[model samples]
Target: MKLAELAKELKIPTESFIKFIQDFDLELSECISTNFEVKDDFAKFARENIVFLRKYSEDLNQNKSIEDIAENIDQPKDKVAEIIKKDKPKLFDNGKYKSSVSSFGIDNKLGGNYKFVYNYFGKNTHLAERDFIGYRDLFFFVSQTLEPYLSNISVQDWGIHRPAGIVLYGPPGSGKIFWAKKIAEIIDYEFKEIKKYFLGISFVDDQKITFNDFLIQIMKSEKTLLFLEDFDEIMSERSEDESVKSDDEETKEIILHYISHFEKENILMVGAANSLEKIDRELLAPGRFDVLIPVFPPNMKERSEMLFHHMTEDLSPDALLIKILEDNKAHQLPFWLEISKKMQAFSNTMLIDFTQSLKKRIRNLYLKNNSTTIKITQKMLDASLRDASSKLTGTYLDQIQQFIYDVSLNNYEDFTVRIEALKVEVEHYKIVDEPTKPIGFTHNDEIKQKK
Candidate 1:
């Protein structure tokens, strides 16, 4: 008898059936994809959710009362009913749990020894502030692409087929990964991050696997999102022209195969690259990544919001401070937040003092170095900044910009002076340049050079 039928016959709640399955540690008989294809799975790792979900199939027939089933199963009748009532469709496999892709490592393996590569890309939430800013159009585009696939579970069964797979392409440190992370959070999906160095080819003689292979395997996951953070490393057009064309072709073929195979009703795939032009045209075609979304740097409004979000004590969103922030081109929110935290570390100060402190810090950062020299380098900055425009400026922002320039040029007496002046505490930076690098340093010149 089917799992659901067995539950009904015993008068047990469907939840209990699922829990029982979990308790027994049994796997499912069949493995299904977003398109409903039963993939091979001898591991038989059955999930409680899917076990109970077996009831949804039309092929299953039930002729038992809850009480009868509960009595036979030695469980409570009300509990059985509760499980049935709370059931909801999922985007992930209900029962099968695979090791997190993180365990495999992040890398771009062309033909070394790795068989399959599982790279965790960033989520969409990373770029939320950009969306709230004037770039409402861009934000809407990304939201529309992701919302339908994420908000509705039935989309996995039958839903609008969005021909476009999202591609976030930009320079390094532009917030690409941050945007990816935020998107997942806003939609309540789990975040999976993968780096690019761990990718390689491995084999027991003829059998071979690669980082791209690992990705294809995990990309088939249900309900969960797979983010290709620095996608350019592997599927990039640059890789194609380089000596790695053969391996690049293999990865490209995999992408082409899936782009054609993806069922809008089931899975959501997102790819992010540093340079869209560097991306292989075949991969970005209508079928592959139909929607090419560019994640730019923080504008003034976004910068301010990012600054405010990171502030410890509340500061008035006064016109004066806003005006100042609007003038500094490189004083994006994330950068401002870093400066603010650094100042707070020395002492606790009021808003006016803090603003002055922030301004001073900005001046040192951009002035000594170059007006463009930010604490973070272009490549190390969030990938989203590649297309972003500056929004912060005014008295406060001007001072901050001057400070940054001073630092870039090495004219500032003590870089820590501004940090000391702000009386703000330094906090860990939220954005990462490379997924594998635990910490990154910005070169004075690297931060100063503009697009």
Candidate 2:
């Protein structure tokens, strides 16, 4: 087979094919174009090491580090370095290197290794597997988002032009941005923030140039989690019915351009929005973003986890804690519960705030004895809950419930049931606690005897 024909069949760049000729040390001229004929020797080389060649090219194209490339192929770094130096020295330039296969017939609109830029956003973030905790089902769903990267599967198998992106929508302080960072850490993908990128662009022409260049760089190099924080403020709905007016045309174009790019770009565009209603109706199409995950305020079970995680940090006995909880008549029958049912709708942030306030209150209450002892009392916790902003209004809760129903309509039936169950739980949350102790009164009898 001719090298050009091989390039067409494999759908790889002609430059990469030339690299095969140079690497295998086949009978090919230095000036050989795409039309160069393949010999029996090159055919045998392809047959024996085709898988290796493909992986090598992918690692190179991703601009992986020398250590990573070596580890991936199960070869030593020194050996791989020797192979590259002996075979293709053109790739290395003054300690800088380019992808082994790049600058195809796409007309040089974009090309570069930008893995550094992507990973820089999440430099200090090291989230362990346990750090991604929420619900068991939700954790599984988020894990599935990385299926394409974790396996040999292709997006075409799922009938998608490119892998779908995720949009996490919920109220403020619900840990939307935090999850995005953790997801990126799990996949070890490049994490790039979008808001600052827009602010850094100085001119209209620069918007077009920067967007095109950056996206192409992302598509070529490796996987990326593009965190579009404040997505609602950035990308407004596309109003096709009328001529939409905007004070900044450049910003508008930049947003629409990148959102549209998710259709074909392999990168994951994780957009966080407080409300899905603010997003454009058209942008929810299957190709743009396939998943609409609702990050509602922690329900009863999750709120309990958050509370216990913070509350049980002391060595105090469970007996003491239960006694303190029982005195307030707040958590009802199960002493393990955190906060009253009315406060279940409060976000994790608000719950943490409430717990911290309790600690402070407990300290002040213990000071009445003029001692530094850490003996927490019921009065302290009750006063703290009253002081903290644990009251999520009825109207806001109703809105969140409606949003859950709306988004669940787009998901599987099982997910719909899970979300709907929360509403049912909220309706009956005010169950009264039956006290174990009763009061005895002799005031009336004593008064009659005295008379």
Candidate 3:
């Protein structure tokens, strides 16, 4: 059964249920497919725990003080306060906790009976069986946003029309283009990139044509998703400090003029941007590129899955590398967990770089030893980690921090967990170095000397 269908049957809000899975740290792959198909085990668990699910959903949707949560869970107020303090959930203006603060997380921390939750994870869902690794929440969010296109009634009854333009904003290597294509696939539109040349006057079929002409031609064709890269630059607000290119200005004006016809002509324009801080407000007005989807770096679990996927992707069962991975238990998720933890805030591109570097290092080691029994060591892993960290520079981290802020303002409610997690990871880089002390000087002696 589909998760949404099951949620309807149980009278649980679909969004709440999705948050419930994340709050409790449930193994998403074990419970549901990437497409939100409910596995048999998860469906059984939900039906059997309907009362618990309903109460949990209710608690999750309301702001509550520690005392209130304690009363609801039948726990002591002091204990509840301690658990909540340790969790560090976001607080409301009224001095209560926000709904994003998961009661399920607090309950589990206080030794709540959640062993039944693990019972649903007994059936292992292989990586090969899934469409992609992690980002179940993101996929679900995109699905919800495209509901109008997916369901005719969503538009006819609810007046929810498909967005004419969407801006997928994220730091470089966060895979904004991938989500754009995924959006196209969801709406059954042909994915067509508006190439750089297409933005300028170009000859098509040996006939002189402008971007305006190109857009008109696309409108006349079958349903198409026109992808615009460097969206922030192209649609940036004109400023005195920065000179705007004539082509960019022309392109922006043309898009603004024709955007009104996009939905009616069966075209959706998805803009890929590294940031939205400079985009013109006029472009983001209603029925324009108003929908902003923030693509994120892989979280801890996703980093592990991506590492394993990259390592063992096409290797044969009997290949030397596979044998080595098996020997080290590197084929398992737990093996990558520690390494992935160290890779906090690493982008998808960085993770792939780590895998590539690791493979090359392993090859060099094999060449030197001329043996198939070479063991992967911590030194080798560390070397590859350093290579990957080369790309996780301060500039990239600043971009991620900016992304977190942008999402906090625009998409916080939808992606609270991700935003919070990313905030912690980004702050990890802010460790200031200690001031240098003179030789043979104790801390107190140095202070006295200064005085």
Model 2 per-residue lDDT tens digits across residues 1-451:
5554454556654446554433332223222312234555555555455674565456446654456555555566676565454323233454534565222111111222333222322232111112433454454455445534443333544532444567887767778887788667655677888654543333455444355455566667566788877665455575565343352334445545576665445578888977776566645676665577767677676666566555534434554444544454423424436454546557667777777887566556555555444444556656666765534444445445555655566554425435655656545432245323121112334437969
Model 3 segments more than 4 A misplaced: 1-11, 23-56, 74-121, 152-157, 428-451
Clashes of 3: 0
Candidate 3 C-alpha lDDT tens digits along 1-451 = 6666787688898777777776676767677754456888788888998998898888888998887788777778898898776556779888898875666767777888888777766455577555577897788788778766665645776688989999999999998988998888767889999999999989968999999999998999888999999999998999899888999999999999999999899999999998889999999999999888999999999999999999988777788898878878888889989899998889999999999999999888889898867788999999999999887765677688788878989998778778889988876775345325211113434346869
Q: Write the per-residue lDDT of candidate 1 for residues 207-248, one digit (tens) a residue.
A: 786766766765566544557765665676654447545655
The reply for model 1, stretches above 4 Å from the true place, is 1-137, 150-160, 186-188, 202-209, 238-246, 313-451
Residue pair clashes in candidate 2: none
Query: lDDT for each of the candidates?
Result: 0.41, 0.53, 0.83
What's the TM-score of every candidate structure? 0.38, 0.53, 0.82
